[model samples]
Target: MSDLPPENVQQYPRPPRIEPVPHLVVVRLGGETIAETTGAFRVLETHHAPSYYLPPEDVRARLDPVAGGSFCEWKGRARYFDVSAGGQRAPRAAWSYDAPSARFADLAGYLAFYAGLMEACFVGSERVIPQDGDFYGGWVTRNLTGRIKGARGTEHW
Candidate 1:
């Protein structure tokens, strides 16, 4: 037998969905060609709707500035960032956690963009339709009122 220790074994959890799903797209200000992510990354994927989490290092830091903050019971406290482009600024369009809880630490310092604010947002070129209430920002297909509750379509967000 090999001398490798059992502790070195690495097993990846079966994701709800696999690659080539065409689930995410990145658009920068001034119609810039940003990175396009097709695969569902671990820290940002969800069954109902997948997400694209960009590390702070991947974003154009020159256009980003700490703007606000929020909290999540599951993920922990979050800090927000504003993107400035062409003299116009989108405040709190991105969010991250510098020190997330153990289970969520992989998301630390990684940025999640709110598609509702960007100039162009898409899931493989499929534009995001905004839901009712300007307070929340995500891909909105239809008026999901009674269909969704507590932000996640009933008991889940």
Candidate 2:
């Protein structure tokens, strides 16, 4: 639906590629801008949507540690965060890999949000679509192509 050329997720690397994102990224919730950054990083993997991790300093929302955590083979363990802003709360809507593997060291302190839990998430001036499923925190943009993972049949991907 966008004029921009589409990129297939199948073309992305397997072990996952971490790259700095110079474009502005923003997250809005409850009529407030909870996070905004031009210094974010993106993790692109085969069959998955791109996950944007924003610097801690760029997020305006208060984050509280959640009770449970998850593990990622490539990033190590991930801790969840409850995002609170403008008197609204979204529990465990964000996550961070405090001590990521050496390959993903840049994401150690950055937080990746679940776009479905927020009022809106943006990449540059374009609003993003949250990758389907509650577990994966990928942000879908117009530039991405191919069938994304995270749907029911994609559980094994």
Candidate 3:
């Protein structure tokens, strides 16, 4: 738990809100820093953990294009990236919506990582917890509260 006040994920907007994150975001894999950024964006949706998106220039590791992709109604088609560093590789560990919807245009060219696939992911001084489930890339920090989605019983949420 954190000393900060709790923020319920349920309070986030339905369509999701994309906003700039003032804190530092970092990602590590294979004992190497793959991505680090002081300027990043966060996607907050109701009952879901906030997904931090880092700018392309901020990523320090190599990102190789992966075959196949996914679709998001709000963010448009998504492409996957395989992160490689320090002789370690995490396939499809990152994703980006090159041409996002109008509401999420700011996310274009930005990348979001999966905490479970990386050695570590951080927001400020806090290490993040991967949202439950393999498909969702939500990041859970100490400041968040409420029953988050992505768990077994939350399939309908």
Minimal lDDT window, size 10, model 1 = 4-13
Comparing 1 and 2 on lDDT, the stronger one? 2
In candidate 2, stretches whose alpha carbon ends up further than 4 angstroms from where it belongs are: 1-5
TM-score per candidate, chains pooled: 0.60, 0.96, 0.96
In the range 1-157, model 2's lDDT, one tens digit per residue, is 6543478999999989999986888999889999889999999999899999999999999899989899999999999999999889999999999899999998988999999999999988779999988778899888888889998889896
lDDT of each: 0.50, 0.91, 0.91
Candidate 3 wrong stretches, greater than 4 Å:
1-5
User: Can you tell me which runs of candidate 1 are displaced by over 4 Å?
Assistant: 1-24, 38-51, 61-63, 141-146, 149-157
- What are the RMSD figures for all models against the true structure? 10.8, 1.2, 1.2
> Where does the lowest 10-residue lDDT sum fall in candidate 3?
1-10
What digit string (tens of lDDT, one per residue) describes model 1 on residues 21-124? 33455556546534455432423223123334665555653346575677866568887778765455777777777887776666777666666667765554
Between candidates 1 and 3, the lDDT winner: 3
